[model samples]
Target: MPEEKQQTPPGSETEMNVKPDHGEQSYVGHGRLQGKATLITGADSGIGRAVALAFAREGADVLISYLNEHEDARETERLVREAGRKAVLVAGDLADPAHCRSLVDQAVQAFGKLDVVVNNAAFQMSHESIEDIPDEEWNRTFAVNISAMFHICKAAVKHMKPGGSIINTSSVNSDKPSPQLLAYATTKGAIANFSAGLAQSLAEKGIRVNSVAPGPIWTPLIPATLPPEKVATFGQETPMKRPGQPAELAPVYVLLASDEASYISGARYAVTGGTPIL
Candidate 1:
């Protein structure tokens, strides 16, 4: 018998030859986000799945926003419900400003209120140099990563009361640029600046905005975005010598979304496997 071909570019967990470990059983929570309603983009797999599981465990009803990957999204929905919380799946291209507005509106409509908005959806392509970067890809990268955040925040804030939280997923590449991933890095830098600026602007309303800049973590993006050789040595360059797990990053999201981080805003938390950002 011949082997089935594997899907690429945000591979589906249900179709993956060996399912990527999403930390559903391993992540532990202490109800830090209890009663909060969180909407997470790219929630079907990888870091988004990890965060979704963690949020559900902490007693939050989650609205999962994903693009395609229906099987993975269904699995995420299953896991969220299994964690004893509600999960609402919102599917579409977040690159659209209208869709971004709808994401916040649908979540608020379904959950009655929106407390945490996690802008985690993104796309990246690796090229050896900036000259090789496609203009369309560069523009799309910024649209999905930074523009979508802007849209979601603008729409969600209308219904988000005081103490609402917005957590954007920046990347280590924001501060430490990866020459090959020029366009992707640029968007991440913008996300960092946007988070800081939005945090300050929303301070008077008591709505906190922050960002998480993760170092190399084992995710589907590794294989989808990088060459196979690069994928094989993905996190080897990090000081930890291994990519950080999604489970490891989940707690940071929980902390930032919880009342425990009441005093925190406009801060960037680097979960980059001992990679010094300074």
Candidate 2:
């Protein structure tokens, strides 16, 4: 596989070495999320987009949030609409606290209520040395990865009722920190802790909070954030020796969002192909 390192930060899916597989044709929903309303960040592509498709197929209306991937976001909306569910697209930088709050408000305004929130948007970059990482880059990573989740969750909990669910996107890096991904790995650890603590705190409200720790998945974020050399061999180090597709994660997300997970909270679910998170 060949990869062209992206010149811009947070690379676009359209310019990827290999565009991610979002399960447009394969994912089948079993009405697990019937009549539910969901808000998913990063729903323009990758795991978030796949989750939106599955949720809609399972009979949930989705409100998608993305930075500025209008074309990709529109395709996600089309998939949701094709499933006979409502799709609302909101574009902005979630790194901003006000924008994070606005996403919650938009979801509430569009759906009237929120049943599920998937904080799946994130930012990452690879650097050889700490000296190579800038102060603003470190802050931006935290702001988009963990702080945005905190801000959005704070605003979203108010509109959610009993049996609502919140799923945060963590990473296998949390268990095995990658020195090259210091900032991203750190934020993932925080996300896991946040989910566990919030789950306990929200027990009275009956809102289940959990995190999904994924290994190397073939998403646009990979090529965009990594050096060209690393991108070409991405995920080859994993036991599976291949990156898991975005569609492969949709089922786990669907299960977490469904009421069937009523008793499953405060847990970190690892979807790292052949890697063990513990």
Highest-scoring model, TM-score: 2
Q: List where candidate 2 sits over 4 angstroms from the true fold.
A: 4-7
Q: Show the colliding residue pairs in model 1.
A: none
Write one digit per residue (lDDT tens) for candidate 1, span 1-278.
11223347765556534345667668776888889999999999989999999999999999999999888889889989998999999899988999999989889898999999999999889999888988898889988888899999999998988989999999999899999988999899999999999999999999999999999987767767787677666778999887787778889999999989999999999999999774
lDDT of 2 by residue, 1-278 (tens): 76465647666777776778888888888899999999999999999999999999999999999999888899899999999999999999988999999999998899899999999999999988999999999999999999999999999999999999999999998899999999999999999999999999999999999999999998888877888888778888899898899999999999999999999999999999899987
Best by lDDT: 2
Residue 171's lDDT within candidate 2 is: 95
Summed backbone clashes in each candidate are 0, 0
Determine the C-alpha RMSD for candidate 2 after optimal superposition of all C-alphas: 1.1
